[model samples]
Target: MRQIDPAFTGQPTNSKAHKAVDPAPTRWQYRMERLWLTPMFRAMIRTGIPSFGFVFLFTWYINDPVRIAAMIDWYEGAVSAVQDRPEFMVSLLRIEGASEDLQDDIQEALPIDLPLSQFRLDMGELRSLLVDLDPVLDAEVRVKSGGVLLLRVTERTPAVAWSYDDGIEILDATGQRVATLSDIESAGGLPLIAGEGAEKNVPEALTLIAAASPINDRLIGLARIGNRRWDVVLTGDQRIALPEDAPAAALDRALAMNAAKDVLARDVRVVDLRLPGRPILRLSQPARAELKRLQDLERLSLVNTEGTQ
Candidate 1:
């Protein structure tokens, strides 16, 4: 029952004499490997084609001239809607330069409540009016989303009050006319300046007066002379005639005399401290009488002492 190769048994047989069988072809199996990789490469192309197609379609739709025209129409409608609102009109009473109430006048003309975004700000009439009223308006107006106009303002500070060309006016410290005023009492601590160029020299007078205040509280007012000379006035209607050349020295001497001899408190009419070496004293009648009484007392004491000797 066992079949054995005759070559191994060393027996010659026809079946045992056949050639060796060949190995199966591996090339056919290699061709099947391409199927696995082909699908992945093809799927990449399919995904990119649809993505690109959607991008081109949407871009064309949005940027088309028709869409741009529609946007313009919408903007015009929005502007017309709010252009007639009441808030855009500015109001002024007795305010100068504007022919009409800024608020009321503008409203009457424009009659629009259009939001700022829809309107052109560079219109010639608007810009001219804004510049013309810049000094008074101080506030810039802007229309908002709810058809409400917003105003922001800043005003300048006036410095002084003055009387010029027979008309009284309030001026800033720099001498610019601010407003017309009634009288000097309401003008506050500004010096009563008169004569030529008083406004120009206010700063100098203010400086000197401020310096003298700490030393003398009786200094109530000042009078300037000939644009160069100055005179100081005190309480009780007493006037101190300062020197034309050295006013500061005159004031210093007067203050010194007041501290040493209570010159200001004396019943004197005026103390002419202009001459430092020899001051001219103008005495009231009562002050003269008091001086005589003091002299008599001194003489009587001397006479009594000599008698005792």
Candidate 2:
């Protein structure tokens, strides 16, 4: 038996009939197929989508204020737990090279409480605070291994006592102000300097004081004159005014004169050493009047002798 042609039915067959076309995909389907073939789209599917989903869920979890507060509290609690460990605690403070009075000042100045965490201490700031004190020349601060806060301080040594119009202040060798004293005698045998700008010329004053050692028993102090020169004030109001340049040499010269002639013991008010070659002795009021009276008597005698001759 012959097979029947499905295209040609038992009815009329028209030669002019068009062939049936194969079905095409929809626009959305075609676009989806094209997108699937792209490498960027595949990468987005592999990584971007999962990352976005994770971030969205995370954001939702943390969006609540209560959850944020809980997270912050948990972080702070963890930090506090680490900081409060026994091994990291500073329970003792040891001060070295500081005097008893300085220790008291340091203790009063420190803004920390004992038995604190080492992590909470600011070493640099503490050292700066210690050095800021007038008596403290230098300082070191460190935390030892066995929970000790160690402080090493170097105190300024008082070299001279500066007495100005206001008050007296103790100065170190470098002329740094150390402390205030009630009086010049409280400086404890340190050389005394007086008047304005005396503190700045401490070295010069000390030199003069050294040079005047021979007459130290009669020396009172060195006074700064016009912030340029010094006047060595001795007992009985005798002043030896020294020049600005090589004042130590001029002081030495005056000291030599006093030693040789016993000039300072006389009725002298000032020994002017401003000129290196020439020394002027300014006598007291009584000595000046007496000298004037003797000069008048000598002149009267000379006049009377000339008239008689």
Candidate 3:
């Protein structure tokens, strides 16, 4: 038999014996390696990395207000640049249903510079400004194709001329002030109203004037008596006192009587129709003198006839 070496016999040899192989891994290390190879572990790793990255990014974003504001400004600027393009610009304004002077006033009141983008104009604010004008009763604004802004306006119509302490003012049917006039003559053919609270009853006064159409040309103006009733002033300084309850009806009756009896044509200072059933006439100085003279002549003639009998 051949002699066996000690190394082969499980004894250490002088030459570096084959290094003892590392012992099998520890239990914890073995378990870790096994767990790392599992599908669940891989999934957890994938999900946790993204979650951690998100947390860090979110925290950084919340801590910086200046950065957020800068981002917002950048977004607004980008959007504005897109909207302010030449195709979206409003270059001309077209106004309709306004007089020449009113058109000039509207142009002066507009808050926009020419050639501005529609996106920069606030339609609501522009509408409010237009409606605030004294002459503008109603208004409409629209953006048309071809970069034109269309403004349609409805102006107030003067229904009556009011005489105030300052001057004469033209009023619409609703008692709204339309414009100031130099005098009553400047009001054209509109009826005149005077005294406080007369403007509030313009519609009623106009109705009464309409009822007195037969004598309207001779009717001068209407005065609000004690702010309750109306006194219809006619030419030659004649006044017709009207009842407060139904002045229009009273005026119509007086006009009808005048048409039949020529009462208004007579030399009367005042025709008082204030009482319900009683009508009083205040004659002018010449009319009163002529009546007294006729009465004396009749009495003298009657005495002479009695003496002859």
Best by TM-score: 2
**What is the C-alpha lDDT profile of model 2 across 32-124, one tens digit per residue?**
999999999999999999999999999999999999999999999999899999999999999999999899999999999989999899999
**Which portions of model 3 show Cα errors greater than 4 Å?**
1-69, 289-309
For each candidate, what TM-score against the reference? 0.41, 0.80, 0.75
Ordered by lDDT, highest first, the candidates read 2, 3, 1
Cα RMSDs, all models: 14.4, 4.9, 7.1
* Per-residue C-alpha lDDT of model 1 across residues 1-309, encoded as one tens digit per residue: 989877799886685568767676477666756653687756766776777788899788769889978888999887766864455432321223333435454444443344443344434544345434422334355544444444433333444455455765555555555445677777676544454565676655565566566445677655665766666667776766666666777777777777798877877677776566777778877879898999999999999999999
Collision pairs in model 3: none
Q: Which lDDT tens digits does candidate 3 get at residues 86-185? A: 8999999999999998899999999889798898888888889989988889999988999999999999998889997899999998888888888777
Clashes of 1: 17
User: Candidate 2 lDDT (Cα, whole model)?
Assistant: 0.91
Q: Score each candidate by Cα lDDT.
A: 0.60, 0.91, 0.89
